[model samples]
Target: MSSLPINPPPRLLMGPGPINADPRVLRAMSAQLIGQYDPAMTDYMTETQALYRQVWATTNEATLLVDGTSRAGIEAAIVSLVKPGDRVLVPVFGRFGHLLVEIAERAGADVHTIETEWGQVFPVSVIANAIARVKPRLLAVVYGDTATTMNQPLDELGEICARHGALFYTDATASLGGNDFAMDAWGLDAATAGLQKCLSGPSGSAPISLSERAVAVIRGRTKVEAGIALETDEASPDVIRSNYFDLGQILDYWGPRRLNHHTEATSMLYGARECARIILAEGRQAVIDRHALAGLAMLAGVQGLGLQVFGDVTHKMNNVVAVEIPAGIDGDRARAALLADFGVEIGTSFGPLAGRVWRIGTMGYNARKDAVLTTLAALENVLRRGGVRAGTSGAGVDAALEVYEG
Candidate 1:
């Protein structure tokens, strides 16, 4: 079989995730690699943790990366924290909500998920009631779900968890850098995120932070090694359950003593660090404001073009907009034309809502007026080509221009 070379097309990623990475992050990743235990490399690790502290809005000394995707960090936090037969309550308002329940269950927790309609979020009353009734040991939820472009209202829920004495955990993979997230202020015990989304970096690293309370719980379960505990003899446990993912020893390894865990993904660490650096340098509130304004532009443009929106507008994710696929417009065909003809890549929905919604993401470096306007224009053209008598011509671009100018 004739195989093709690795060269690929340059298409704007206006999709749900794996959005366009910033050029600075890419450059950082391209720099020289080093040994995991090297002094210079460990310096980067420390700096990376510090940078993530700013991103996550936490002073957690244990803030660090797990060497995998977003799900890995979620699993590490859930499995490591919850003991067998622990009662965990999960809120299922979107696809990621289901993920929280699944992860907790697999870790031997007795998981009970309270589900609402896919496009909606759990009311604070419902969450409080669930907690009062179930009295779960932990509460796992998602901040934003890319599947439906919805952001759960977490402030009140976090307060409820605290009042009920249940540790709160969130997967902020799809919205961490793209929107507002206050780990400490919002009373989160543990939170997980990936570099692939708004962080505008590669997918190999998961940034995670644990509260002091969370650390106490995990530390309470630790079994001291008999050999290692003795001063005269030294031996580590059998690679910590799963060597690559174990975060217990990882904390010590990354801590002041410079112990050894898995060989951290050096390139990805560079990218993740640079990602947080950019966000911190830009300022967290400013970043969130930028995403808000630019996202609103995209939303208005899509609406101006006569495309319907999916989900409640009030609770939608700041960086991703979900628009309904109109009649007579072949969703797949329009997506193809947008990519091949216009060099843009918007997203499609999944599961029960498949073939109905087109997810347009304004994330990372791409969450700007220019990118938003360009995508709106390209999508409008594709819609016109696909037998839709819509798109206010250049109106979408005009509105975006106003946002950019202001």
Candidate 2:
């Protein structure tokens, strides 16, 4: 076999996730590694947790990083809080919702799901009704499902869960930082997110936070390691199913105990720390406002090209938009042309929406007016080449500019 180098072409990522990380974050990741328990390393970890508390808008003491991808955070929260036979209500809106269902099921949760059409989100009353009926121990939901480009309304669900004595959880991988998420104000007991989305970092680390209530539940099922066991150490027979994903043990690593769990991913920790720092430095609301502006511009541009936007626009995420593919144009062909010619990447939908919609995102470091305009211009060229008619050559850019200018 021929030897190959690691060089990769640069492309503007305007997809659902894994977008370009902020340059500062990439730089931070390049710093030299240190021992897990080194004073400097532990200091970075503490700073990271404190930074994420602001990013997540929660004063939750258990906020910290999970060593794996965003899914690791999701699994840790689920497997730790949801013991075997616990009831979990998952409101399925898109592919990620199904993922929550699968994880909850594997955790031996009595999973119950209420779903709406792929392009739609559940109303508060609908979810409240499900909670009342299922009487679940946990209410797990996806704050933003990139597969549908729709953001489920979550403000009311928290109170509903509280009224029913259920713990509330959400996967914010696709929405956090780019959207208005108040974990504490919304009464979210547990929330998990990735750095790759609005946080503008790579996907190797997951930032998670838990309320005191969730910590209590996790602590109850905590188990001490056989090697580290002592007479005074507390252990539970119902230890978390996956040691790698035990949030209680992970908390010990993050908490004042500074207990050794796993050797943390140092570079990823640096990256995660910088991601949170950038967001906090920028002011969370200002960043969210930027995403809203970029998203609006993209939506207007697509509509100007005479394409129908998918989903209930009001409930759509402020970072990603789903555009229905115009008739007689192959969606993949258009996407390929945009990528090959302009080096801009948009996303495609999955499940029921596969091949039917093109998901375009304006998030993370790419959420900017110029990025939005350029993607629209590129998309218009690709669509036109594919024989899709628009009012004019510059219609997409013009419409987007109108939004930006306004």
Return the top candidate by TM-score.
2
The models' CA-based lDDT, in order, is 0.85, 0.92
Instruction: Give the clash count for each candidate.
Output: 0, 0
How do the residues 112-219 of candidate 2 rate in per-residue lDDT, one tens digit apiece? 999889989998999999999999999999999999999998887888899999999999999999999999999999999998999999998999999999999998
Any idea what lDDT model 2 has?
0.92
**Model 2, TM vs. native:** 0.97
TM-score of each candidate? 0.93, 0.97
Superposed Cα deviation of residue 344, candidate 1 (Å): 0.8
In the order shown, what is each candidate's alpha-carbon RMSD? 3.3, 1.8
Clashing pairs in 1: none
